[model samples]
Target: MTNAMWTHGVEWLTAATPDPRAGERAWLPGDGTVLMEAGRHWDLVSVPRQLGLLTLDILWYDPARTPGPTLVDSAAHRVGFLVPPDPAGDWSGEGVRHASRGAWVAVPPPHRTARSLEWIVPPDACTALHPPVTLRLALREAYETLAVLAPVC
Candidate 1:
């Protein structure tokens, strides 16, 4: 079975971190890491898992204050591996579990590892982050968004 085509929207804000002023945020598609200003210090967010063509974890920085309605700026960073379904595997309703429109699921990786922490994502779930449009355009948009929101240093 072929992997379904899908995409997800970028996250605008990340969960609170240990430091109240600093956090990590994503500015581009396929970006494995990001740095953001938290007051006078810079914080880093790294990809914990290998990135795949289809799946990614949402990570972004949320500032304590902003001038306008935008509380969070820039595209969210993601970390995860892709696991498109095997063409020979069954895709019917035999063992398919009901998932939300954009939920992530843990699945066996294409290659086995001690971690065994791969994820399978539905096409619709990634619509915002990885849209049906060309990746170049999507990445450009993400970068522009980041430029506008990222602080000047």
Candidate 2:
């Protein structure tokens, strides 16, 4: 989506910030990205960049399973998927980092899609954060797909 099209999605993401107005001023224009805390509105499922991208492709291609907002940090080689809060901290995907409480994530304004950090799928008003099980299964699928594709000795 174009930067102009993401205005509403940007607002939805910014509302998660500790200081919504400050986040707007800092990242919305020329300032850079902002950090929003995890576990309040939702938690995070942090995945390796490549695998996450694979999973993203899988999810996006399937019209029945459009995931929630996803953020990618190319420099860090990390991708984070937003999921509903895990009050029990029971998410146990093989390699996923489920950030519940006391964790934060860097979120880029959607206008900066060309930047190191940007949205893979910008959030809208209608959807809920990804279900942990769905994200976990997709991640596992990505990993297995990669394993099969690798050149073997």
Q: Against the true structure, what is every candidate's RMSD?
A: 20.0, 2.4
lDDT per residue for candidate 2 within 1-153, as digits (tens), equals: 655556676677777877778987876466387778888788888888888899888777668777888988788898888988886766555566887778887777765664688777777655568877777778778888999998999
Question: Which ranges in model 1 have alpha carbons more than 4 Å from their true place?
Answer: 1-107, 110-117, 120-133
Each candidate's TM vs. the true structure? 0.23, 0.84
lDDT of each: 0.24, 0.77
Q: Tens-digit lDDT track for model 1 on 15-70?
A: 21233223222223232222312212111111212221211211222143111101
**Candidate 2: which stretches are off by over 4 Å?**
1-5, 91-95
In candidate 2, list every pair of residues with a backbone clash. none
Cα deviation at 45, candidate 2, in Å, is 1.1
